[model samples]
Target: MSLELDINAAIKAAMLGKKEAELRALRAIKAAILLAKTAEGGNGELTEADESKLLQKLAKQRKDSLEIFRQQNREDLAVKEEEELAIIEQFLPQQMSEAELRTALTGIIAEVGASSPADMGKVMGVATKQLAGKTDGKAISAMVKELLK
Candidate 1:
């Protein structure tokens, strides 16, 4: 996959630049890719969709860790996680802005005739499929609730 090439290039650049944060994130990504390739039942190669899903999973883990660090007042750990999160997120597709998400959700809501929260399931079934990779499910659901209300 082109992702492997881009990641290899990034790793070299980060090493040359001596960027600790970038180096750490890149190595994690590289390791994840390697593991994925070697995992049973997986092809030795990753598809574009598979790679994107992998990156998103890494980003989510970082975010969860970051939040816990913040809650426990672990600024040192939180800072490192934040840096990694930023680096990991760069590989994900650009996410929709709030206004854009709202507009898109509104259209979906109308399309599905979801005028009440009771109809959220109907809207979500379609919205999640259509908007996959564009935004987080939590963000989409929160916005949907607001719009429906």
Candidate 2:
């Protein structure tokens, strides 16, 4: 099933169950889908790739918020952000574990002939495309830096 449809179903379920946090997260996703559909230059349809990108963006925002809230010692806000992040993550593809990511990045490094940090741009160009939905960009970059060092 398409992510949009799944999100709509989840919204309905959340509403029926009176799950406020889940309902909030699902509504945010629904709003994003609507915006994407009507956005200039958009094709009025949500492809699987587009959905994945949208979900990743939302997840990243929530994660950033969570981190900031934690740093500021705002437990209340951080908890909300954490809950939203978890909800958003459910729509994303399974993330690659560190070991798995390392293995993949090692192969990519070889394929791109990236031998040192200087080759980061070359490796990143390919890695971003290859691992887009499978892992977070920050994690990928960190692992790439570690592996290339």
Candidate 3:
């Protein structure tokens, strides 16, 4: 199923199951889709790629918020954000593990002829394009840096 269709179905299931956190995340996903559909320059609807990008962006925001909440010692808010993140993540592809990410990045680095940190940009450009929606950019970049050094 397409991400949008799956999200809608999940929303219905969440509502039926009385899963509050899942329901809230699904509603947010729906709202994001609506906004994307109506946004200026948007094609009046979201393509699957656009939907994936939107979902990834939402998931990234939740992860960032979870970090901030933890840093602020707001355990309640942190837990809430973590719950939302988990719900959001269910729609994303299974993430690449650290070892898997490193292996992939190594291949990308070799493919891009990146021999040192100076070539980090070249490696990152290719890696991000290839890995988008499969892995987080920050994690990929960090691994690339570590491998290149």
TM-score of 1: 0.91
Instruction: Give the lDDT of residue 133 in candidate 2.
Output: 89
Residue 7, candidate 2: C-alpha displacement in angstroms: 1.0
* Residues 118-145, model 1: lDDT tens digits: 9999999999888877888889999998
TM-score of 2: 0.97
lDDT of 2 by residue, 11-82 (tens): 999999999999989999999999999999988998888999999999999988888999999999998888
Q: List runs of model 2 lying over 4 Å from the truth.
A: none
RMSD of each: 1.5, 0.8, 1.4
Which scores higher on TM-score, 2 or 3? 2
Ranked candidates, highest lDDT first: 2, 1, 3
lDDT of 2: 0.92
Count of clashing residue pairs in every prediction: 0, 0, 0
- Worst 10-residue lDDT window for candidate 3 reads 43-52
**How high is each candidate's TM-score?**
0.91, 0.97, 0.92
Give lDDT tens digits, candidate 3, residues 15-38. 999999888888998899889989
